[model samples]
Target: MTRRRPPVTPDQIIAHRRAHVISQAAKVGVSAACRAAGVSRTAYYRWVKAAARYGSAALVPKRRRPPVMPTAMSAQEVSAILAVAVAHPTLGARQLLRHLAKHDVHRSASGVQKVLVRHQLGRRAQRLAALASLTAADTGQLTDAAMAGPFGFCQAASVAGQNVSMDTFYVGKLKGVGTIWQFTAVDVATRWAIVALIVGDKTAAGAARFLDHVRAEFGRLGVPVTGVLTDNGPEFVGRDFTSHLGDLGIAHHRIPPRSPNHNAVCERFQGTLLHEFYRPFFYRARIDRIADLQTGLAAAITDYNHHRPNNGAYMAGRTPRQLLNEKRPAQSAA
Candidate 1:
């Protein structure tokens, strides 16, 4: 035998009907609102029974239970972890674990990974695929020009006693008002460099001034410049540059156009200058004062030639100055 459900009163039926009408009008619908209100149609009917037995208080809902505690890490700890990750984004989980260990945080790599995943901070697996798609493919073989030569072509051909290569770099932005150019000359075999900062357009006059500086250095060393090899820039090929070289009785050879490899010695030294001195000096002390910058450049060049090792030559154990001094005996012998 089955028990029968209690009868619903008129007041409860009216309240439930009113709720259903309002819910459907609000777009929540009767079914959704009942679910949200934690009441079934049967329960609504039971409330009607209560209303029949009692009054309007039967329509009221029961109190809801409190929410459960979250398993997520604290905000402070997450902030610290994020700060560390940002400072060294390239660090792997093992490295990160080691770094954290030093700071007294003992957590497994897998545990850290779980935390990262929970916070939506895990490295994307598709990032590597995207990187691969973006990278350029390595083409075929290198030509003779592209290949690194034995002792490099510049060093191999340039006898320590003779050849020099000259080049120029713009030191200032030409905002129409003015500009400065740095003209540099490097002894191909010895790695000795003479740099000059000239305030003006990179004209023939600027090149001539640089030549004069090189001439003065040659006088001190008591060595005559036999040949000067330079790129086919306007300043080097101009009448003033040619006439000055002619007066000094130095043979000038213009490198084949677009072939910097022929003058690789000077190019390599320029890279060293930019890396070891120019970049650091410019960063620490802004080159706003031209005179100070020039003085600093000169000192840098002196230090480079006298102290820096020359690894390109047979005299690898010696500095540029020491190699040049050694070259004097070889030149005298010749």
Candidate 2:
């Protein structure tokens, strides 16, 4: 059997009863009406005065007033919490509290969380976005003419070739060529990208070939590709790909299932290639040959890595090529 909820009389009914009591008082007397209505004389008088001043609508009961808590966070504390949260977007409230304390801003983890929630930054994603927005503003990327991207605060690579993210893009079928796949590899630190086009099917062998291309490209930069991160796709996880990485002495890192953001650096570069290069190039020029497309892709990659100013985190208004070149002397191009 379902349990019954406590009956709550509607506000209209209460207002009507109060109105009737006032009317009854007009007919008989105030004290008699109060006794009949089972209400105190003081309450009856107060309601009468309220109805007269604010109309009969005022006869309805009001909810209990909220009390102000003295222990609530101060404005400065809230500011500190928010600032710390945006600085370390990936950190939780407890982790952020320590940072806040470093700035001499003391607050409990729960208090910091409350501030975060109030500002609609309770989630780590929201915090990341806040950091991105802040970075965009700092880098002058956010303007009336152009707005910065969502991943503007992308994680910076500490060292070149330490971590390389790889992914496959299915570049639709051509009339002459059956199907084409574009394999992409991006250095996490410098955002240096390498694209290889494969006609027909994408296999583990193709992926391995792409790895070799990445090695050759980064090899020119004088940095050995140490680790390769990719999604848990068949081509990437297959024995052939694994064996190739082993042969080259490169570590293979696969992101967890259903988490595309883990390999987001590769994903972002692929998106940039699609929107900035392929889409625009295809719109103006017709390309039926894979070699022609590869030629265009190579030029686009060169422009992207060398010319285009990256506003992402740690870039400091510099291009990926600039960072890579700087790393050449130190031998840590990340």
Q: List the residue pairs that clash in candidate 1.
A: 9-48
- Candidate No. with top lDDT: 2
**TM-score per candidate, in order?**
0.50, 0.60
Q: On residues 28-52, what C-alpha lDDT tens digit does candidate 1 reach at each position?
A: 7556756666667565457556766
Which 10 residues in a row give candidate 1 its minimum summed lDDT? 133-142
Winner by TM-score: 2
Give RMSD to native, each candidate.
21.1, 13.5
Q: Worst lDDT window (10 residues) for model 2?
A: 140-149
Per-residue alpha-carbon lDDT of candidate 2 for residues 1-334, written as tens digits (9 for 90 to 100): 9999876679878999999999999999998999999999998889999999999989999988899898877777778788888888899999887788887887778878888888878988777677666654465233211111233333334467866889999898877977999999988777788888888888898898889888888888788887888889999998899998998898777776787876788898898889998999888877788888888988999899889997866667889888777644354434
